[model samples]
Target chain A: METLFYIAAAVTLLATLRVITHVHAVHALLYLVVALIALSLIFYLLGAEFAAALEIIIYGGAIMVLFIFVVMLLGPLAVEQERTWLTPGAWVGPSILALVLLGEVGYLIVAGDLPAISIQEPRQKAVSIALFGPYIIGVELASMLLLPGLIGAYHLGRRLSSEAR
Target chain B: MSLQDLIVLTPILNLGIFCLVTMLAIAFRRNHARIAAFAFVACLLTLATLPWVASATPRAVTALLIVDRYALLYMGIVLCTTMMVIGLSYHYLHIQFRERDGIEEYYLLLLLATFGGLVLTVSVHFVSFFLGLELLGLSLCSLIGYVRTRRHPMEAAVKYLLLSISASAILLFGMALLYFESGSMTFRGVGMVVKQVQAVPGLWLGGVVLVFIGIALKLGLAPFHMWIPDVYQGAPAPITAYIATVSKGALVALLLRFVTDIGALELPSLVHLFSLLAVVSMVVGNVLALFQQNVKRLLAYSSIAHLGYLLVALLAGGPTAAEAVTFYVIVYCAMTLGSFGVVTAYSREAGDAEQFEDYRGLFWTRPWLAAMLALSLLSLAGIPVTAGFIGKFYAIAAGVDAGLWWLVLALIGNSVVSLYYYLRLVVTLFGDKPASATTPQGLAIESPQTSGWMAICSLGLVASIILIIGIYPEPLMELIRTSVSNLLMVAQQKP
Candidate 1:
């Protein structure tokens, strides 16, 4: 479990680095998808299995598809813009910042102040129970929260309710 | 969950059902009046559920929501004002139904935003607050730009979206760090943890400051108030009123609740941080309004000053301060909604009823509208006969009681400065119209009889409330005092 966690962390870091460095918007989005999946794997290792599946389905799958759709909508102009934006010189700044974060993580791990307690992985049943039981108010409120976004998207996009996918 | 839990959560749950019902209503019929009626009924039903919910007071539904008296009072205030604003908006939306796209969604967004405001007032957990903030933000983004073809509304919505996205990021990051520091996501849990520690940790302080920044950004306080005037000028007057009142009021209530719970006012450094924010907001907000030609922008600056006054009272930190803050919020909402109600009535699609020129000779043309607008402005300026004056006096009293002399002095000075602008607006309304102003190119000011009287009636209702409160504030003051005391009962009783 510990080994899996470390590998997921490393993949997350590497994928995130690639996400920022990639010039093409499509490529960056792909890297983001990889990073999101890796982070979800870490979530699974820690015990939030429901959250892990959601991270994959929502962020990795649905949101990434939306990003691709937008990139396609932008068409050739976006790629042309990105090519100028992601020069070799531009890489130096983000790379330095990423490396600094990596160093900080390394220090935190090595300082021995970080204790690794064995994480108990709860089953899907318990997670669902917790969500639907006492915490059902949160579930209810979250749905209420999303409705406005749904309406806003429909309104601003000027799409008819009948035409909604 | 048990039946009792369901009963305790009825207010917010009622709104949740209303949102779904409104969605279904939209699908069933696209008529403006039907949708507005649906929204109005939903709002009233939700408000009526409050007393039922309050009967189950001090109930904590899970770890996220707390339905206490403070929450109930604030929720009632937010919902009532929202209902009034929605009525004022009916004629505005109905008139523009042809020109505006998705006209039915206006009521949907308003209800959603109201839900967000109510959630905010009761949120004891970071998750609930964040969800509420985003819900409010998303609805407002579309509502601000409901007239998509217009340039100013589009610009304003975009500005709101971009700035608030960053603000939410900072706020979330800060919440994460605070969670890391205390291993808690609830305010009470974090407060308990912090109370136990002898010396406050630096990381915790940093996170708190970030949270403050996020809140100040939303509240349109000084140093973070760049978006206020533009957004106010651009959005429709009713929405501007909604944003100014419902959006910021809930956040202020939340802030006060959190600070009181955490005993944040006791920390000298945090005190200084708040005092600094309060002083800067007062000075900058009042000084800037002195030069404004547009009434919306002028009101926007004055709103900043009003928030500053609340902060000063908040900084005072006592039973009196809490009561003052609550009473002031109700009065402030009434005046603001009334003033903007007048604006919404006269506004046309060709041009906004925004400039100083638009208001010139308003007294002669529409005496009732002019009377409401002027009285509201005078109330805002804190004249002796208006509710705003009593609100200001209470705020100053709270500050002085706490020995926050600097903030109190600044409050007095800013009130004087604000008077100049408010009086100027009043004088301009009574001034004779120039020939050039009477024949503007784009604007076609609707004749009073042709224009919507719904908005005028709403404005009249709000203005009367202000006057009533101004004359006899003891009843309102006593009510706030008791509720605030009820709110502090939990912490005080245990200790």
Candidate 2:
């Protein structure tokens, strides 16, 4: 189980890196799906079965499909723009920064006195109760937050008619 | 929530319901002036509920929000600032959009953003914090880019959206780590764990540092301030004022609550980190402002410096610090709004009158606006006879009381350094019109009848408040002291 966990984590990290470096939006999104799936596997290994399932279903499956649909809708123009933006020179700076972050994370994991937080397989019923009871305000506020996000997306995406100008 | 909880939350609920109502109103009919007035009245109604809310002082409505005088005070500031922003937006959108353009959504987004700010002031849990922050952030992204016809606002919006999301992610990660360390998500619960701990654990310290860094980025502190000038320059002037005042003020209020609740300032490392950020922001913000040709960008840098001065009060960590910070935020909002109000009044269909050259010889033409702009600049410079001087004096006094001598000196020196650019702009406002200087028709004076007088009245009110606070700060100080004491009582009782 430990070895499998390490493999999944490594795969997630590699796929995430590919997602970042990929020039094509579709290709990057495919890599992102792979990363999400591997992340779900890690969650399963950690005994968070509900989280694993939700990660796979929501993040890996649904979000990826939506992203791919949008990429296709945007067509190949975004790919050309990405090519212009993701020049080899751009990679060097970000790669260096990522390396620095990697080193810092590695050091913290090795040296820091992190809390030994034991993971429990959270029951689905318990999660639901918490969501509806103690966290109902959060759930409501999250929905409220989505309203402006939807409005913003629609407002920005709408084409202005000549008369409007 | 119970009936009492619901009643205590009246102010936030009023704004929330009004946000939805504004949305419905826009769907029904799209009169720009009517909708602006609606938003204004909605904010006024919310402000009116504060006295009723005061009757239910220091009540924790669930684990998520606290209804106290502190929250109420900041809520009042946020609502008033939102109203002023709405007033300025009325005239701004009036000029920026024609009859056929759908500009009503700007008011919807503004109200929603203000709703988010109000939520932020009362939040005690990470869940509420993240929700409120994102709501404010996402709404602001749209508000910044509301004019899609322009390239800069869109670019600015995209920049802000990406950076803001990144910051939010960092903040979430920090919260998760802290939750891991302490097994708590509520500020009071975390405060209890911190109080009981002997030596600060590394993970907890890292989490606290990351959270502060995330907030500093949002606040446009020194190292994370790269985005401010561009966003300020690209956004509509009124929205820029909103971002500067309401958005930043909400975050400051939240940060103070979080720090006070957790007793985070007692950690030596955190104090050192804050001091470093304060000095750097002061030096970098003022020094950069000295070279700005654009008035908007100059104000952007000045805001950075002003927030740096604000951090000193935060670090002082007492009832006095709380009072000082509250007073400083109010004064800052008033002056910033007044300054941006002048810009919005002068802005035309082409773009905002952001260039320093635009205000040149303004005293010769449109003396009223020139005077308002000059007074705002003088106030921003912390000159005597302006509210800003008193704000700065309070900040320095707080810092000195806390034995933050170096920070106080840095703040005082930066105030002197800041004077040059502010005075430079003031000079430009009063300078002779060059023989070759052609007054663009956009810069030409508009009749008060066509241009909304609501904006002018709001500006006049703001300027007078600044002067009033400068001359007689006793009443405001008394109010701030009471509110701070109320907030401190809650913090003390929690542990």
- Which structure among the candidates has the greatest TM-score? 2
lDDT of each model, Cα atoms only?
0.83, 0.87
All candidates: interface RMSD: 4.0, 1.1
Candidate 2 chain B lDDT trough over 10 residues, lowest sum = B442-451
In candidate 1, which residue ranges exceed 4 Å CA deviation?
Answer: A1-24, A34-57, A67-126, A159-165, B99-101, B436-439, B442-449, B493-495
lDDT leader: 2
Which residue runs of candidate 2 sit more than 4 Å off their true CA positions?
Answer: A71-118, A163-165, B436-450
Compared with the true structure, model 2 gives a TM-score of 0.92
Best by DockQ: 2
Span of ten consecutive residues with least summed lDDT in model 1 chain A: A112-121
Model 1 chain B lDDT-worst window of ten: B442-451
The superposed Cα distance between candidate 1 and the true structure at residue B212, in angstroms, equals 1.8
